[model samples]
Structures are given as structure tokens and as C-alpha cells.
Target: MTTLLAARSDRPVQFLWGTNVLVEEAALQDIVRDDVRLPEAGPTCEDLAPARFVTNPAALEEVFLAGMNAVARMDGAPPITSVVVRIQGWREGHGIPAAAESSPYVGWCCLFATPAPSTAESGCLSLADPRAGSDLTAMPGLPWGRQVLIRPVPGALAIAPGWLTHSVVPIEHGQQLVMAVATCSR
Candidate 1:
């Protein structure tokens, strides 16, 4: 029989059965907005929020513990682990690139899907591989965990191996609010 693990929330985003993992969005968002420190990037100043914040220290601790629990189930994977709540908006090539080598941990990209803007041009989320020796033009198909592309519905989650290279398309001048927590390690 398949055993299902319990999550912090009962929302559909918490379900763990897809190309990308999911986490409850509302609660997760509240926790992040109440705790973390969002910074700005120098380059595009768009790679990330370019600016944002994380809330709820206690909740963050819980996320870390949960991450550790996931690592423990990996059998022989490394012990290092981390949990983070990330926020970003529309940008040409956003997000971290995939790794060139293999890692011993996993990553969960919990997309907080809110209401879609009036138009697709308003905001969009896209992902790609980097370590495969690829630039924006030379990138190949979304690597392994990078198969599914989501438009993020507030309260939706997207979790996958941490090594997966992902990015957000661009927000133009509209509002595309998305928050994700990635649990990963070396």
C-alpha cells in the first residue's frame, strides 16, 4: 500500500504527486511574509524580487524540520539540508541555473498561485537548465524535474529536486506574486 505523508496544511497544494511538489500556499505565504528578509539583486534587479520579505520564525523552523524529515527518508543521501521561502516577479531569465554535477539532496519549489493577472503578458513563470553548459539561447528541454511549467495559482506549491534549474519568464509591468520554499542540501 502507498503511504501518504501528512503536511502542515490541508489545501490541494500540499499534495505530493506530480512533476513538481506542492505545499499549502496561504499559510506558507503568511509565514514567509512575517519572517524572511527579501533583498534586491544588482544585475537585472529582477532575478528575484529584487526585493521581498519572509515572516514567522517559528514556522520557518518547522519548515526546516520538515526538510530534515524528507532527507532522512532518502536512505543514503547526505545530511545537510535547508528550507527557504523565495519570492520573485517577471524577468527574462530568472532563478538559479541547474548544477553541472550531481548533488545529494532535493528541492521543493512551492509556487504560491494567486489570481492570474488579466493577461499572460502581465506575468509568467518559466524554468530551464544551466549547468548543462547552456545559456538562454543554448538551453535544452527543461531537465529532469523541470518538465512541468506552471502559471502559479496563489496557494499552489511546486517541489522538485534542488538541482533542477528553473526561472520566471517576466512580469512586464504587471504584478505576479509567487513565493516558493525549496528544501535542499549538499
Candidate 2:
């Protein structure tokens, strides 16, 4: 069954979450840790995309398509075949420092490729209230204060609209391993 997660029932943004354990959790962790090992100044979106990742294509595809389908269900959109999926992991100091933003996708899926830290500051995904609505504003001001926090659970999945003003709180404790899959569809 699908469950809706929102700060307010009237909110325009829809966040859905559930569990999906990978068959080989260790493989996902190895791929991400290797990518983030003593490298770039900060993690970029491209770093998370699947092209740069070294994991089984089937595993990625299985999760990606399942995620897109869930996105379609939430937004009442059509699920088109052939959507690009990307994923990356951000350890402490590698996650988004500040600012919540959106991307160009119907929606996306985020799951723990590896176990996440217990501390909430371990780069958890924080999002503004969806009641802010999805539209360009005359004045660019986000309701950052009205936010909801999603602490990634191992083998769990959270899906939300790309338009939601969301950011990863900087990882302060252990590493937070996340696998994100996005698909751009009109």
C-alpha cells in the first residue's frame, strides 16, 4: 500500500516513502565509497548519476523504474519508457552545504545504498512545506523555515516532486549513503 507523508494535508507537494532492500547492500556501499574516497571538493549531481557508478545495471534499472512508477502514481503522470537514472553517495563534508532546490524530473527516488548515520545531521533530506506551491514567484523567496525532515532509513525509499525546495543537511556524523534515481519526462 502507498502512504502519503506531508507536514500538512492541504500541502501541494506529495512525499511518499517505503522500504526496498537491495539484494547486495555491500555492493552499493562499495561503489559509492570508492567514488567519494579522498576526491573532489564537493559532490556534484553528475557524480551521483549512474554513468559514473560501477554497479549492476539490472539492480539500478529495477529500482529506478519502480521509483518512476511510484512518482507517476503520486502526480497522476504517465510513466514513459527510457528515462535516465542517476545515483551518488555523499559522506560527511561531501553533501549539499546549504540551500534547498529542485531539479528537472517528474520526480525521483532516494534510498540508502548503504546504512545511514543515526544522527539527524548526517545529511538528511530536508524539504520545505509543499503548501508553498509549485509556481515561479514574482519575488524569489522560499519558505525554508516551514520544512519537514526525512531521515533516510536503510532499505527504505522516499519519493517526492523535484519542484519541492529540498536540500541535504550537511553530513556531520558518519557518512550518509544515498542512491538517487531521477527521470525527466514531459
Candidate 3:
């Protein structure tokens, strides 16, 4: 069974995580094969298949719905009217630079062949504190000033607000794959 987890903060930033999502082996192989065939050096999203490429599209959609509902409930944000789904692959030493989504929300599902090793936060999603000037203080019992790291485990999904600044830690060894979903309110 799939389970959804949420990381709530006193600040505005929040993250939703889904675990135990099921994807067919064939689908996984197809995505990896296509990624390997591509010639891009850094993270590549071009020519990737749509969300339908996944054998079980409903599983991912569930995560998306949960994220949308969370945003609506907590932030009282507008409903998401559209979403752009893409498959992204990262090779060794390649990682996404820190950036915020232009849309209202963003979701990602790790499709790696294996879980990233725990050392040095390999292939982990890193989220920065959204509050400005929070880094200036070093106090106990404070959520700000520390980054939230989400390890890369196959079938693990994460969703966060678009305004949240986030990036991926470069993998030291193997390739890292993920399905990215961006949501629009308009």
C-alpha cells in the first residue's frame, strides 16, 4: 500500500511525500533506456515521454491530487487547473541548480534503479528555508537555517510549493531518474 507523509513547518513552506508507489518493471526499463540514449550531459528533460509512459499513471496522479488538496487546505491556494509532467534524468556529477517553479506547485517522483547511498546526501532533494534572513541566526528549536533533505528512493514522490527553493544533490555514482510534475492554477 502507498503512504503519504507531510513535512509541515511554522513557516509557509511545506512538503508532501509519497512512498511505496508501484511502477511496472517494463516502464522503468523503458525510461532508463531512453534516458541513456539521450546525449545531454546535464539533467535532460527533452524528448522524454509523457506521464502515460508510466505503466501505472494513477499512482502518480494520486500523489498530485494529494499535493493539490494539501495546498488548498493549508495555504488556501487556488485549485490547480493544469499540470505539466516530464521525465528527468541526471547522470553522475549532474544535478539541478537551485530554482523555484513558476507554477503554483511542483511534484517529483524518484525512479532510480537503487536508493541513493546515505553518505554525503547523494542524490537527495534539498529544500532551502523560504524565509529571508533566517540563515543569519543559529538557534535551537528553529526550523529555518537548516536545509531539508529528501533521500532518493525508487518510487518515492515529493510535492512542494512552487515558491520553495529546491535543488538536487549530485549523485556520486549511478544515474538518478525522476518524474517531475508542475501544476498551474490558471
User: Could you say which candidate leads in lDDT?
Assistant: 3
Candidate 3 local lDDT, 88-130, one digit each (tens): 6555675778888887777776665343455658777876645
Task: Please give, for residues 9-35, the per-residue lDDT of candidate 2 as tens digits.
Answer: 666756433222112122244333244
lDDT of 1 by residue, 58-150 (tens): 564456546544544543445554544444433322333333214333333333333455566333334344434323322244333343455
In candidate 2, clashing pairs total 3
Put the candidates in TM-score order, highest first. 3, 2, 1
> Between candidates 1 and 2, which one is better according to TM-score?
2
**RMSD (Å) of each candidate, 1 decimal:** 11.1, 8.8, 8.6
Clashes of 3: 0
Residue 137's lDDT in candidate 3: 48
Question: What stretches of model 2 exceed 4 Å from their correct place?
Answer: 1-54, 97-118, 130-146, 173-178
